[model samples]
Target: MSTHLCSPQHVLVLNCGSSSLKFAILDATTSDEVISGLAERLGSDTPSIKYKYNGEKQLIELAKGQAHDAAIAELVKLVNELGLADNLIAVGHRVVHGGEHFTESVLIDDNVLTAIEKTAALAPLHNPANLLGIRTAQQAFSTLPQIAVFDTAFHQTMPNIAYLYALPYSLYKEHGVRRYGFHGTSHYYVAGEAAKLLGKEREQTNVISAHLGNGCSVCAIKDGKSVDTSMGLTPLEGLVMGTRSGSIDPGLFTFLTQQLNYSVQEIDDLLNKQSGLLGISELSNDCRTIEEAAVEGHPQANLALDIFCYRLAKQIAAFLVPVQRLDALIFTGGIGENSDIIRDKVITQLGFLGLECDEAANLAARFGKEGLISKGQAHAKAFVIPTNEEWVIANDAARIAKEG
Candidate 1:
C-alpha cells in the first residue's frame, strides 16, 4: 500500500543553456522560490553571475575563458554560503531533449547519463550543457539525488501519426529521426493551471498552448495530453521565432545552393539564425521593439508583427481539429504573457473561432501575472499565464526523492 510521503524539502533546479545557466531553489511544500540567479556569458571574455536572495541582488565576475564547470562551482558555493545546501534534498536539471528514451523525470545515474550523451546529436546546443550540470552537481553534492526533468518528456505521449515525418522509413528507423517537441514542461504546467482555472478535471480539459519567446511553439492538448505540436524534430521547425525561419519550404535549400551559391551549412545558418521576425523587419527580433516601431508607422515592423500573429492564429485554429472541444487558448512565455499588442493582434485573427479579447484584461496581464482576456459568449477563453518550469522541475525531483 502506498503511504503518505514525508514532509517537503527544498529542491535546487538547474537549467543550462548554450551560454547561460539559471538556477533556483524552491520549497516543494509551498511552491515558493527561496532564491534564484543566472550565470551568463560563460566561456566568453566577460562572464558574470547574478543572484538574488532575501530580496537582495549580488553579482560575481569571472576570469576570462571560464566555462560551465567554473560557473557551477560558483553556484555550489553560493548555495552553501546562503545555508541552502543542507536543506536541498534533491537537484533537478532541465534537459532539453530526451529523444524517445525518457518519458518522465527520472533520477540521474550512470545509465541516464549515458543515454543523455547518446541523445546529444539530436540537440547539439543543449544536451551537452545539461550533461555538464548533471555531472558537476553529482560531484559537488555527491550524496543528493540528481534528477533530470526533460523538456521533451511531456510530449512523449503524442501518437505515432503526429510524430512521424514523411521522410524515408529507413532514416527514421535507423537514425531515430522524428518530431519531438520542445517546451513540454511549460506546456504541461500551464495546461494544468488552465484546467484549474476552469474548475475541471485535467482529463477533461482541451486547450491550445502557445509558448512565444525567442523560440516559439504551439501545442494542442486534448484531454490533458499533447496530441500535436508545432515544433518538430528540432526547435527550428515550429512557428517563426526571433531568428528562426519556422516551416520554410525545403526547396529553398536547393534553390539557395544552386542559384545563390550557398553551401549547405551556410543555408542552415541563414534559416536557423538569420530569418524570422528579424528577417522580416530587418530591424530587431524583439516583439516589443518591433511593436514600438510599427506604432511609428514602420512598414517592415508592422509586417513582421502581422506575419507572426497571423501564422500563430492559423496554427492555433489548425490545432482545434485534433481536440473534442476548446476550453481555453493559453498564452505563456515572454511575449505571450506580457505583450498585449501581440496577444490582441493574434486574437483578432482568431475571431472566426469566437475568441474575443478583453482589452483591459489583456493590458492588465503583464510581468508574470495571470489574466483571462476573453469575454461574452466566446467559444474558448484566452489567458495569460506565467510559466514556471523551475517549479515543475523542483516538484518532480521532490516526488522522486520522496518515493525513494
Candidate 2:
C-alpha cells in the first residue's frame, strides 16, 4: 500500500511466458503487492515494460527487444530505483509442468534446473520460458534464492486410480504419459479460502472447484488435496475453454487425418488454439464477448454459452464421485469470479442434489467479491471465492527462502 518505502522480506514473483513476463513484489508479512509489472512483445520490434510503483504507473520501451534478459534487466533497474531490492528475500517462478518429480516448491539449484529442463518436453511452451525467467532472475538477483512453484505439484496427491489412463501401462512407465492435472496452485489457494469460509480446516473440507478462464479446469478437492480433475496430461482435456476444444473423441483425430488429410501438427493447433468458444461462436474467445452476443440474439454465441455451462455442470456432477460429501461448490478464476450469467447457467444444469442459485447473491458476488451464491437454507451451496495464486507463490517462495 505504500508509495515508495517498504520493509524487508518481500517476495518477487515472476510468471514468464514465451514473449511476456509478469513480475510482482509482495510483502512477505502481509502478501500485499509492493510493486508489480509486465513486459510484453519481447524479441519484437516494439517490446515494452509497464509497471506500477508508489501508486503511479510507468511505461518504458525496451528497444533492444532482448527477450527475458531485457525485461529482467529493466525490472532490476525498477527495483533498485525504488530502493526495495535490499528488502527482497526470494524470487518465485511459476513453472507450469513439474511432472511427478516436484511434489512441492524447491529452492532452485543445479539439480532443480536440470529437472525443469527435463520436464520441458511436457510443457514445451511454458517450462522453457520459465527456465529463461529463472536464469534471468538469478542474474538480476544473484544472492536471493529463486524458488520454483509448480502448477502440477499439488495434484500429485491424486491416487493412481484417478491419474492413470486406460492406455497401456508400458506407455506410462516408459514415457511418463498419464493424467497430471494443471492449475494445482489456483485450486490449492481457493480450497484453503473455501475452508476458511466454511469454518473448517482445509484438511477437513470437500468441494468441487472450477477455475474458469482462458484455460479452464475443475478440481475435485477432498481433504485438501486433489483427488481428480477435469484436465488430464495437458490443460486441453478439460471443460470447454476460451480457445481449446476440451475433451474430444479420440477418433476425431483419425477422422480429420483420413477425411480432411490433416496433419498431426494441424490437429494440435485445431484442438488447442482454434476450437472452444472461438470456434463455436465464430466470434471471440472472451466470455464477455460471447455473453454480450448471446444477449443480442446471436444463436451461435448462445449455443456456445450453453455448451460451456452444460459441459462444466457435467464435470461437476462427475466429480461428485471423488467429492462424496460436498461442502460447497466453488467458482473462481476470471470468468468464474466475474460472470454471474455463466455461474447461474452452470449451477442450474447441475441436476442432482438441487443447488439453489440465489440470483441476487450471484450478481452481488461478482467483480472480485467472495460470498455464498446460494439461497439461505439450501441443501447445496455454491460460493464465489476469488483465487489469489500469486499469493500462494509469494508465500511458498518466502517459506522456502527461510528454510534454505
Candidate 3:
C-alpha cells in the first residue's frame, strides 16, 4: 500500500439515525461542503431520498420497506449517477454511544466495530442503525477508509463527581452506568466556534452550549473540554426534547408499573418516544406546532412551552457553576436556530446570570447563520451559532485517513 498522502480528497460524512440517513460530501483539503442530502423514512411505506448539489435538488423514490443497507446502496447509486467525485477517500459515521472506551474519533476496524456493538444497549435506537450504516458504506465503497465520530466522545472528559449517579455503587460498577452525555459533536464544535467568534483562545474560554432540537443537551465547556453536561448514561437524561421526557422521579416508574399495570416496555415508550412536549401538548411533538397552539391561547400548549424553557434555563444555570468565568452561552440545533420566541424566553430567564439579549439581534438571527444576541455590555455573552456536526465528522475522517 502507498504511504503518500492524498490531497484535495473528498470525504463523505454519514449521520444515520433510527429512521433517516443524512449525507454530506466535503472537500477534505478545504473542509467545505460539496453536496448534502437526506434519505428519510427508511423502512416506512414511503421512502424518499433527496440530494442537493450546486443549487439543484434531485429526489429519488425507493420501494417501501427498504432497510438501511438498501437505503445506503440507493444513496451510493445517486452519488454516482449525479457524476459527483468518485475518488471517495474516506467515510465518517456518527455513532451515538462509545461508552468509556472511545474518547476520540477513530479509524474503523473489526475491533472498533465490536466495541461499538457492545455499547449498543446504551443507545438502543441509534448505535444499531449507525453500525448498519458503517458496514454498508464500507462494503459499498470498498478500499476507502471509514471512521467513527462518537456523540459521547466530547463528554468523556467529564469528572467523576459530575458523571456519577446517586445510585448504588454496585449499579455504577456492575452496569457500567454513568452520565455519558450525547450531542458531544455539536457541543464540541459550537464551543470552539463561539470562542473563535469571541476572539479568545479556546483553552482560555468557558462556555455553555445548548443544543435544542428533537433531542437536547447542555454542556459546560471550560478550556474546550466538557466539564459537565445534562444528558446522562443515555440521551434520555437531559433537557426536555421533542418526544423524550427530560428528568423524572424514579419512583414514578415503579408506581406506574405496580399501580397502573404498566410494563417496562410501556414505561420506556412513554419516557422515550411518547413523552416531552408531545405528551404534554397532546397535539404534536414539533415545537413549531406547539408554539402556534400556545399563541392561540391553548392552555396545555402554553404550559408545555413554559416548562421546556424553564427547565432548559435552570439546567444552563446549573452548568455555569462549574466554569470560573462564563464567557458565552450558545444556542444551536433546530428550535434553537429558528425560533426567536424560545430564545427570548430563555434569555429573559437567564438575566440573573448577566445575559441581556438585544431583542433586535435575537430576532435577526435565523436561516442558519451565527450572530451575537447579547447586549454589548452584558456580563456573559450570548450567541446563536448554527451547528455543523457533519463537517466535524468529515474532518475527523479525513485526518484519520491521512494519518494511515
Inter-residue clash pairs, candidate 3: none
List per-prediction Cα lDDT, in the order shown: 0.91, 0.91, 0.89
For 275-319, candidate 2 gives per-residue lDDT tens digits of: 999999999999999999999999999999999999999999999
As for lDDT, the candidate ahead, 1 or 3, is 1
Q: What's the true lDDT of residue 193 in model 3? A: 95
What are the runs in model 1 whose C-alpha is more than 4 Å off?
A: 1-8
Candidate order, TM-score descending: 2, 1, 3
lDDT of 3 by residue, 1-404 (tens): 11112335788899998899999988777777777889999899999888887778989888989877888898788768755545578999999999989999999999999999999999898999999999999899888889999999999999999999988989888888899999999999999999899899989899999999999999999988999999999888979989999999989998999999999999999999999999999989999999999999999999889999999999988887788789999999999998888999999999988778899999899889799998967668999999989889888898999999
Q: How well does candidate 2 score on lDDT at residue 10?
A: 89
- Residue 275, candidate 1: alpha-carbon lDDT: 92
lDDT of 1: 0.91
Model with the higher TM-score, candidate 2 or 3: 2
* Residue pairs in clash, model 2: none
Clash totals, every prediction: 0, 0, 0
